[model samples]
Target: MKQRHEVFFKQLEGMRNYLLKVADVTEEEAQIVPKGFKNNIRWNLGHVFVEQYAWIENLTKEEVDFPKHFNEWFGWGTSPDDFTAETPSLEELKPLLKEQIANIKGTYGDRLEEVFEPTQGMDTLEQVLLWTTFHEGMHLQTILDIKKVYECLIEN
Candidate 1:
């Protein structure tokens, strides 16, 4: 792997670890849609997982493996209120998130600079991966906010 690609992978792994740490709440807490929030910790977790796969699929034109119903449960514009079935718990999601960086590196580490027809204005796999990282960061902030709300609620 190139040095830059190694750095990118390490950054991704670090960010994912931090996100998992921030999500250290009970399953019940993960399900709590704090007042004024559109979704809960669980929803944000699932969305990040699904969104990464969706972006990679768009770039590679290849299907990526993820749990069934993840798209319906967590896709963009989806809400927990719309879920028709039970979704993965934090326990399930954490392992998937932990493994995702390794999988991404193994699958695309050497292909980062490879160019493809533009998707969402991104022509390189690296560009799409950067965008996905930004997307994950945004949802990580949401999870932190939700965690704060849950903590306050418990204190009250």
Candidate 2:
């Protein structure tokens, strides 16, 4: 693996752990709110998985094989309210997260040199890795905010 890929994997693992910790709390207080900018805990988790899956698929051209609904619920071009379907429980998401991470490691670990191409703006795999890390970090903050709402709802 390249240095950039290695660093991205480390960062991804850290963020995944952090998000799970936050989900543990949020899942305990699951409540339906009438309105909000943030998606619920389940939506947030699925979003993380699907986004990573999207990036991996884009680079490797491998099918991620996530459930069909996930594509509509949290796919590349949609936002939280795009679908009216209920979100899955956090317990339901843990396995998928593990599987996705394993698939990414397996497929990309050896194929780094051949996997990515410099596109219109990005000129290297390192740039793609950096973008992916930033994407995960952005969602980490969103997860934190969602956790705060969960806490407030529980307290009220």
Candidate 3:
């Protein structure tokens, strides 16, 4: 039978849809750092993907990592002003954000109850999925706030 945590993917899908709605914009738009904000929509988009993957890989003692550049560009403590020539455009990040969700679904949908041997407390696949969902939800709200500020700045 399919893993019981299908609801987790459903929640992620809702979060993904909301994040896409906020992150949908030109590369130039996604690059804007609103007056009080350190990062923009693009950073949050990449972050939502990176942090989830980071938790799974780290907590499970798995070797999987996001692309090398993801840590540099979107890792915690990263800021939008740190952009280098190699920073991904919103166009690039948008699809990858969705792909992250789809990849998680494919990887964990049937295996959520499978033991993540490295974890002793809250180490189950279900807990990882749960934590990732909460993290994504937080980022979704942050993206919404950033988008509003960015849009306001654009207008005035």
Q: Superposing every Cα of model 1 onto the true structure, what RMSD results? A: 1.2
Worst 10 residues of 3 by lDDT: 1-10
Against the true structure, whose TM-score is highest? 1
Scored by CA lDDT, what does every candidate get?
0.88, 0.64, 0.77
Q: What would the per-residue lDDT of candidate 1 be over residues 59-135, giving only the tens digit for each residue?
A: 88988877747888889999888766467777888899889989989988999999988999999989998999999
Q: Compared with the true structure, what per-residue lDDT tens digits does model 2 show for residues 8-69?
A: 77776776776677667445543333256545566666777877766656665567676767
Query: Regarding lDDT, does 2 or 3 come out ahead?
Result: 3
Q: Could you estimate the TM-score for every candidate?
A: 0.95, 0.73, 0.86
Spell out the clash pairs found in candidate 2.
Answer: none
Please give me the total number of clashing residue pairs in predicted model 1: 0
Query: Model 1 clash pairs?
Result: none
Global fold similarity of model 2 (TM-score): 0.73
